[model samples]
Target: MTTPLTSTQQAILAYALEHTDGRIEWFPASLKGGARKKVLYSLCRHALIQPSGDNWQITPAGYEAMGRPCPAQKSVPAKPHTRQNSKQAQVIAMLSMPEGTTIPQICIATGWQAHSVRGMLSGVFKKKLGLTIVSVKTDAGDRSYRIA
Candidate 1:
């Protein structure tokens, strides 16, 4: 016997079943922040889904619960192109350099504030693009970042 699913869990499972081959790439707009985490945790705890890379994949029990056949695995899609003249592109280019790039340099080049640059490094570069960022501290008390 399978555990019952809440409406939110059902919806998440349905979306994953219908839209994706198996990967839960598109999370519903209504599920956000901690609420989203809680739902995902519940699903995983119930053996309904498991993490796959940054996304989730439904388990066999999940299919039984959903009364749907498991879909075949799909090829991972390519990343979308970033605008060449965009600040993100500039930052990526700067980080790709041999010397790497400092926050101040990125700020100077993009006219962004210090915090904004840091946010871009964390949010856009690391989280969104899934880029591995390495930070090194210099003798001058400056931090340099490179995509590793």
Candidate 2:
């Protein structure tokens, strides 16, 4: 069996359970710096928690240790998620058009700078969302983007 959990570990795990997202960003105000690191180490050492991005995530072992029922796993949607009224949706809709869209047009539509539009195209659409974006430049010097 793993070492018995400390009260601090229990509290953190309980908080993560209660929140249902399993993200562990909260801590008692008194638990600072080295003390916090020690608690995290203990939780990890016992296989109760795991590092996810910048925060810790309570593991299935954590729920078992806490005597709490585990939350149902969330499923990723088959389609890309986008808020209907968001600027991202607007940009996507514009790109979906057969005529496609230009940087200046997207800038005006989304109220984002040209560079910001380019960054979103590269970072959010291409890299993060794994979208294949087609960029074409016309003889008239107009460059357009579309999702392929």
Candidate 3:
């Protein structure tokens, strides 16, 4: 069941909906400080504005409230995918580098284990950013990635 939101939550949802692009949504810090904790929490809990890697966006309710069709929603919206933590962000940045470093190299640079490195590539980058993994079989081994 959809819980009703207070005016403040609605306001916050409206604002978030107004600004979200595919990659990012900017909230004015001035408006969302400690005083607005409940408002923020409510929007998030109800799946109205989902947390992106470093931003937030309008979920189905938010889209519906704004008189638009909620993209791909059949009923209750799917849970918001969790944002990338700092470690995940570091992995994304490194993988996204022009030189296209390997998993081993990334592990060395970031101090993460091989599993964590692979998780970044498979978990967040592939699912969240919608990127494809690329590799070339060199004489030594497979190396590199590019947005595919």
Q: What is the C-alpha RMSD of each candidate to the true structure, in Å?
A: 10.4, 6.5, 14.9
**Which residue pairs show backbone clashes in model 2?**
none
Descending-TM-score candidate ranking: 2, 1, 3
Which residue window of length 10 is worst by lDDT in model 1? 19-28
Candidate 3 lDDT at 136 equals 57
The C-alpha stretches of model 2 lying farther than 4 A from their native spots are 80-148
User: For residues 29-82, what per-residue lDDT tens digits would candidate 2 score against the true structure?
Assistant: 899999999999988988889999888998888878888777788887688567
Candidate 3 residue-wise lDDT, 1-148, digit = tens: 5567666565565555555442224444665567566566667777667777766667666666556666663488777765676666666666676667677878887898988878878887888768887765555676776445
Candidate 2, residue 63: the lDDT equals 78
Would you list the C-alpha lDDT of every candidate in the order shown?
A: 0.87, 0.87, 0.66
TM-score between candidate 2 and the true structure:
0.58
* Model 2 accuracy (lDDT, Cα): 0.87
Model 3 residue runs over 4 Å out of place are 1-85
lDDT of 1 at 80: 86
Assess every candidate by TM-score: 0.49, 0.58, 0.38
